[model samples]
Target: MSLHFDHNRPIYIQLMEHFYRKICRNELKAGDKLPSVRETAVEAGVNPNTVSRTYMEMEREAVVVSKRGQGTFVTEDQSVIQQLKETTAEQQMDVFLTTMKQIGFSEKEILDLIQKRLSALENGGDSNA
Candidate 1:
């Protein structure tokens, strides 16, 4: 999957988040081999150092493991996956809440809006519009 880099944000953070989402979606399965830093940088139109930084940051977070000669791979630990699931959920909700707050929606209004949208979705409605 392509990394959707937001120019307004830090590239490394954005890259890391992209990988987190991919991992959480099971797109990058446990033990999946990630592209080389140079290759990923080329594909993502970024500097190799930025990609390397992203990988290193992930390694620090225990989201990926890098072998000396072999390349970086997604963590095979089940606990990591479960933790990532919760982490991704919180990140998604934080973004939603921030957007709602910025739009001047009170907490109650946002909750009500979410409930309404969820009900529509459950009833097979086109709530995207």
Candidate 2:
């Protein structure tokens, strides 16, 4: 519940990413109710308005649904959840690839490095070795 905010970005966007991670990891499953805006604001140490904006943005993205009386809930559509997972993976992979390229790693080198790391992990060796 304690979220570290990135001062370079909008808090609401960060909050949305937090929830996206939770959902992708199944920590916040489909149809699960999200914390109330005030509760989330207090937990994240942000203004309630920020939390409200986060929820509204999520709603716009079809990530969650806001009912008239009930609180916001995670989307029940399995396709949405699957898409979220794939999208998150892709974004992370993009960052990884860009960083590796910036560090002068070739495509084949990156692939080999990833394979070696996986092999090491599978053999119960230190992956960072």
Candidate 3:
């Protein structure tokens, strides 16, 4: 698992997002055991305490199940995974909309830009117009 850290946000939140992406992409399957906290911290170059906190938060959210004397595994709930995907998408959309508004983009202009980008992406990144 590879994680990229941005300086502006909390490392734990970024770690959570990284895990979400991995789960969504099937890189980490349900019931797959995650790396040890120390291992992940070393790999990600972050404090071990931060990695532990991220794991703890994931446990609290039912995203992972911990086995005593074993390790932490991804939860085996497809519904929860789907919900995570939807929640991530919604959060991204909210950020996009808020940023557009802050940049003085009118709703119509934002919608038009969305249409243009969607069309281009749907057409394999070739201009559709």
Candidate 4:
């Protein structure tokens, strides 16, 4: 739970994204119980209010559900998880494309770079090599 916070973004949003990445990677499975707010605050080195806000936002997005006297749990719906994965992927791809284009990369160049990286990974070599 060693999260490095980027001060440029809101802490709660970063916390939410951290949890989203965990869920997307299957590290936090469906119906997994999230840590208590106080626990998360301690772990993330943020205020309790930030963790609470993060949990609230996640609930609003239907990414997790809070059970009274229990705790917050990741959504059990597979469709919701699948949609989350797709949405996260699109958001990440959009960011990558925008950054590459900003650096003067054309669409074909980006596509070729991606293909080369994938081929390198498939061949068990470092993509950066």
The 10-residue segment of model 4 with minimum total lDDT is 120-129
Colliding residue pairs in candidate 4:
none
- For model 4, the local distance difference test gives 0.95
lDDT tens readout by residue for model 4, 43-81:
889999999999999999999999999999999998999
| Candidate 3 steric clashes | 0
Query: Could you tell me how far off, in angstroms, the CA of residue 15 lies in candidate 2 after the best superposition?
Result: 0.6
Sorted by lDDT, highest first, which candidate order results?
A: 4, 2, 1, 3
* lDDT score at residue 8, model 2, on the 0-100 scale: 100
Instruction: Compose the digit string of candidate 3's lDDT tens values, residues 1-129.
Output: 456778899999899888878988889998899999999898888899999999999999888888998988999998888888788889989999999999999999999999989988897877554
Candidate 3's C-alpha runs over 4 A off are 1-4, 126-129
Candidate 1 lDDT, tens digit per residue, 1-129?
466777899999999988898999899999999999999998888999999999999999999999999999999998998899998899889999999899899999999998988999989888575
Show the colliding residue pairs in model 1: none
Task: Give the winner by lDDT: 1 or 4.
Answer: 4
Q: Which scores higher on TM-score, 3 or 4?
A: 4
- In the range 17-123, model 2's lDDT, one tens digit per residue, is 99999999899999999999999999999999999999999999999999989999999999999999999999999999999999999999999999988988999
Model with the higher TM-score, candidate 1 or 4:
4
**lDDT by candidate, in order shown:** 0.92, 0.95, 0.89, 0.95
